[model samples]
Target: MKPLNLAQFHLLIIAILLPVFSMARPGLAQIPKEASQIIDDVVVTAEKRKQMLKEVPVSITVIDDLEIQDRNVRDVKDIFNLVPNLSVSSQNQNVTYVGCRGVSPSMINRRNPFVMYVDGVPFSKISGYSADFTNVESVELLRGPQGTLYGKNAMGGVMNITTKAPSNDLEGRVSLDISEYETYLFNANVSGPIKKNTLFFGLWASEYQTRGYMENDHPDQDYYDDRNILNVRGRLRWVPSEQLEINLLSGKEIRQGGDGPMIGDSQIRFHEYKNPDDYVDADSFDNALHARFHAKKFDIVSTTTYRNATEDYDVDYSYGSSSVSHGILDYENTTFSHELRLQSPDDRDGIAWIAGGYFEYDQDKDNEMSMQYLPTAMMNFNRKTDWPCTTTGKTAAVFAQTSIPFFNAFKFTIGARYEIVNKEMNYHRTTTNLDTNTVVSSAAYTIEDDWDSFTPKASLDYRISDNIMTYVSVSQGYLAGGFNNTIDDPDATTYDPQTSTSYEWGAKTSWLNNRLSCNLSIFYMDIKDMQVTEYPSAYVMVASNAGKAHSYGGELEVKFRPVTGLILSTGLGLVQGEYDEYMGYGGEAYAGNKLKNTPEYSINAAIQYRHPSGIYTGLDVQGYGKTYFNESNQDNSVRDPYAVVNLKLGLELSHWDFYVYAKNLFDEEYYTSIFTSSIRNSYMVGSPRTIGANIVFRF
Candidate 1:
């Protein structure tokens, strides 16, 4: 593959930044002489404490509810380019992967580099983190190792999602949307107080359906890629007295769709799943209980959660019409978690601190089959496998951070988390071989394993002035090891845990009298015992500890409101990631290859204007550099650089909103995924141009 061209890259950067400069000139000239609008300071809970975003000594991004609506961000993947140095991709609906600063998930079942939390309860299970947003309040993306506050599986970073809480006053909203590709969506929400200052409740629900994007010409194939999703959530809050409060949250999700089919290498155009029957159906339920007790000096909080999910799917696998049925999968998973924390009162002036402990229990049961038929020989072989696994984890940690101020200008903060986690897994696998209707052979085996680890963090901050602050930090991250359940090979049964150390320096500042805000950060991470996935056989995947790897990058974010109701925002991410030393299972040398699914650079620019007369318009553009799809770094397995644009026009009035939107306005052609397996090589194309309109009413 050709190396990145410097001249072309420079030109693209100029093109992206030109609009920002050109648009600002006119806004500046028209600024009102008496304009005195002071932008409000953002509040965040990044360090497990309520503090101003600018005061936190971490690289972070905060997307509020207003931004969520303006950007039409309905899911986690929709915010990929909105933030700097972050990416989320999926091989299929059941196997989503997230990355930040070039550090990505190496194996499907291995612990994620980053962790996501909903309403203060962690959702480490891969299946549980991709739910739709129903009543979201805000989303916070904290960069660098978060091991000090959130333990293992947070090597890359953390995503905290907060949902809207119940209010004392009654309120309700209804929304409907229609789009191209035969799509329809509906949303409803209601909240009110059962007893003033004593009890409250909130409920939300949404339904979405689509005829799908791809066209299937094969007479036997009914559908190729379609979508249907449903989400419902409820929340209850109780305040019996001034010193104590209780919260209960529950949700359910149901989804049915056809997984995107791989476009074969020989095919000139896309759109077909050759298998006779190919589809997926899955459902899940979640519940969380949280309580807080207030005291004069400190506060105590506890949370408990339970979740259950099931998934089943049939795949063409062969990517050709040569086979009627290739594979089928059935799986079930459950998780239970508990956490307790003690936090110092926020009113304290001398010092602040928090301490916590956590525990989780999880289980998985699955059965799969692969079939082959030789019509000429009048023979058929079916290999069916069943695996059941159970895991329990216990974590005890004492974390405390103290801040000491000098001359009321500089702050020195030191924090450390001494964590000990013990995880044990009990697994069993059985396989049977069948021909025609008879079983030829059967085998079964059981295996057990355990793992443990520790992580720590530290940082310092200097308030350069009221509008600017600079900080430096260093931290260690950890991820637990687990047995692989995809295959029966002994070597693939277990892999070692992965770990990393990160160093970061950054600055946050507000300029032009708080009308413009800019943040910059540079980070470097060194990882050891890096876990990498390998496909040794056509249908089998395993994880192993490859050699070391390193990632270094810088991110910049800017937001400006040059005039009242006029906003401009831009973000740029530049990353360089490579394997310091590595080799694949078959002795394939790849010591200097780039990481998979990680773009070298990304750019996002957007502008929006809102008139006092309740009218608004916006334009958004995003660009991504080349992304490799495999460890081999082959030219065929890459997504070349591409850009897409979106437009939004809306009208707002008291208790009502109407909007028209279009995505991929330029109709850019790109690939969402590229798969090159021993059985077949295929690609999943991105969604095409789409237009839609939405209406909402409030009472």
Candidate 2:
């Protein structure tokens, strides 16, 4: 399918929104006079408490259900541009790299600098980060270190997701969407109360299939990147009394798609690979139990969760060439985690506090085998490796905060948390090589390691006025050390833990009778013993400690409601990141290079309008500056700047919603990742233009 002209698409959106403005004006007149002048408040839980976003001292971005639908944010990758200083790189379904404010982790088994939580349970495994977002209520992106409320793996930031719960009224919705390239989707959800205010249940399911835009010129048959996904979730809530509540949640996600990236260095618009066995299959399932008890002055909460996941894929290692090299990789993981917390009353006037304890156990098994079919010699070269690892960890922390009202107009706040984590891992691996079904070499090894660390955080916040607030904070973050998967050398089996100290100041203000809001923040980070993954040979990759580094950046977010039905929002970020001192292969120095996958600057802008007649339209544009994909910072490793535009339109009747959306309207050719390994370059490109419409029915 060919893409439409960019100019025409923009005109179409503007025409639809502007031409009917006069006709919609009468419907707008029916709105209550006071409602048109009132701007709704946005509530967030970044600080572990429900508060107005403008009152929170930390830097946070909230995406509500409306924004999620208008922007077509299907996954985490889709929302990166919506938040300042956020970026992600995905080479395939098996591996994804995420970063916030230039603080990214090495591509290995080490813990990620950022963490994600779904419905109050931590989703720490990278393999399960791509879970379905079918019934999410809201997403909160907390910037900077979050060690106080959360423990390890939050050095860069945290992403917390809340899913919708059952309501008293019987509600259900079904949706259908169709787009170009034989893409289709079906989604349905139902929720109702089983016994008025005593018990409730909710169920949701969705399926999506698409024939992606990758053509194979070699064979007359289709070589497109075919993808299929299925997701289902169920929830049960019981509130027997006003003081006690219990919840049970379960969900699963299944994703299957083609093997390797569809594009390389050549922008020829077609993927040409001779190998036919190229595919990836991944899935995950999770179950969680939560209970809460409200006391006279305090509350007690507990959560227990179990998760299982698997990722298996086969790819052409030759990059569509005739080298006859291919690879098969597989992983299976299971995890069990539990947490308990106590929280003070929310309406307390003087001081409030919270304390929590957490524990988790994980088991994983991985397998990889590669082969080269040498047609010239009628021979086969093969290598196989299998790994089985287990990890156990326990974390204990106590946090407290107090607010003092001074002169009735100003308030001072101070918060701190002391956390200690103990973790152990056992790694065992075996590798074998065979030539023409005869074993040429074999090796087996086993290793075990234990690590412990203490992290503390403190912050001070002050309010200047009822509509203005500012604060400064200093926080410490840590990532646990672990053994590397590239177990070629006995001595290079384990890497040290990574730590960081961050200093930040921010302000949130509302002006023009709360119709306009602005938030700004600047931060600096000092990092030590950063984990780095390096390729020492054509087939050998190892993890090591890179000495030290520093980074500084700033962000600005603004939202304004010009008129009753028009809203405008935008975010801008600037970052400067470089290694303070570092040494690489052959004793080479790389002390002055930029950080990998960190963009210099980025911007996201959007305008949305809604009328009383249920007509709504929005336009969003996002742009990113140049970024380096490798530590070397060579010119060949840079990805140039690019921008994408999207348009959405919908009509909301009493019981039905009809929507049309266009993503990547200009068909921008952008690369999500580019890296040079073993004198070979690989590139992963972004998706092309997609135009689709969906109709939803609710009752």
Candidate 3:
């Protein structure tokens, strides 16, 4: 498939949204009104309380169900392109790098700066963050440091997702998607009151399978990266009284797929894996109990959550004309968390305040994080080492925030969180000569560490009329220090603590009776002891501190409805960062290199038109600016800016919805990741163009 040029891309977008305006079918007489004439108001719980999006003094984007449906947002990964400044680099179906602003974790580090919360259950672990968007109500993205309220590892941002609740009316829907590459998806959901207004139940389930994109030429004809997954989510709600409600939520995901990432050379190549153990199997389970009691003046909310995730990976580790393909790297993660909070009523007249306490514990049952397939800074060839380890951690925190109204239209807010963390690890390692059946070295040991931090935030906002608002804020971000996945360094020096202070100013405005809206924000942050990867020797790689560093950026989002049936939307995010002072492993100074895995800019633009005859058409473009895969800023580590286009056409009726989409319409050539390791470079190719159709029936 040939890719479209820059000029054709723009013209295609124009054609998709404009052609429908010339038609006025006879069925127009039955159409009530143009749905796009008025923009809908959004409500969000960004600060742990119900509030209007325009009233919150934070930089946030809320993806409502309408937008999600129109954009074909199948899973969490699809959201990265809808929000400005949010980016993701996927090495495969299981390994992905996610970040926001300019703060991201080292490529090899297990700790992350971004965190996600689903129905009060937190998923902060890098390997435990995959889920399908089933029965979802909304997705809220907080763009900057959220350490003050989100508890842990939210230095960069937070993704707070809420699922739809059961209603009194019996309702259900079923959908099936058929696409290229022999892909098939089946989804179904049902929800209704089990007993009038006292009890309700909701359940959603989906199964997906596909013959992956990577070409395989092995005699076995087994393709690489093929995927098969099943996901099921259920919820039960009980309302004992007008003031008391409780909900129980549970979800499970099971996946059996081909080997991990498709590792290719500087150019593309057909893969041939003869290893018998080359496959990936994974499963995740989540359970949570949430309760709320509302009084005349205050509300009490409590949530208890438990999760278990496990994965077994065995891949043919072949890259750049070499192969070391055998054995297994498996891991299991178990977590438990509890949160209790008290907040003022949403309609209370006095000052609003909230206070909460959170506690969590996690355990890594078994795995080999230290002995991986990475071509470290010191080797032209890869070596096989065996290091299996178990790690355990605990975190406790108390937080409070208040909103005080003054001067008629001005509001002042202040919030803070104090947190304590402790962790321990035990591991055993054995290094053997590749050509000999002899063990060159062996060791065993146990290590423990602890750290504490305080993050605070302050902001003031003023309503400059009924439809316009402006605000200024200052906040701090913190990430507790941890240990490296290496036996060489077992102390706190291996994982330095990171902290940052940021300042921001922003405005939100709506004009012409909601026909147009614009939001903008500018921010600058200063960071200390940034955690990054360091190659100490050609044979050893570990995590270390990169001294003083800073970043500044701006964002703009706009929406306009020129005609009653047409809408146009676009957003842009610009971010830049450089190290102020840093010394590499061998005394090589890296004082001005860009941050790894952080894009310079991100953009999302879309246009949509719905005719009176039930015809719906949409065109969207998602793009990212030049990005570096590593901190070196070398030629082999960077990729130029590129954009991908998607098209959607659908029909809507009282009980049916139908659509066909072409994703990556031009079959654009792009790689999700490009890194220079050892003597050559390896690439993780992105998805190719896909053409598919969906059918839905609602009752």
Candidate 2 is scored at a TM of 0.90
lDDT of 2 by residue, 572-630 (tens): 98888888877885476778888888999889999988888889888999988999987
Model 3 per-residue lDDT at 371: 41
Residue 339 of model 3: what lDDT?
90
Candidate 3 segments exceeding 4 Å error: 1-34, 268-277, 320-322, 325-327, 368-384, 433-437, 491-493, 536-539
Instruction: Output the worst ten-in-a-row residue range by lDDT, candidate 3.
Output: 24-33
Segments of candidate 1 deviating more than 4 angstroms = 1-37, 108-110, 266-270, 367-398, 420-431, 437-443, 487-492
lDDT of each: 0.74, 0.74, 0.79
Predicted structure with the largest TM-score when compared to the true one: 3
TM-score of each: 0.90, 0.90, 0.91
- Candidate 3, 452-532: lDDT as tens digits: 889999999999998999999999998877766554445433476799988999999999999998999999989999988
Better structure of 1 and 2 per lDDT: 1
Q: For candidate 1, write residues 251-352 as lDDT tens digits.
A: 898877776545666333557645546677788888899999989999898989888888787766655656633556676777778888898876677678
Q: Which 10-residue window of candidate 2 scores lowest in summed lDDT?
A: 26-35
Q: Give the runs in model 2 whose Cα sits over 4 Å from its true position.
A: 1-37, 218-221, 266-270, 321-323, 367-431
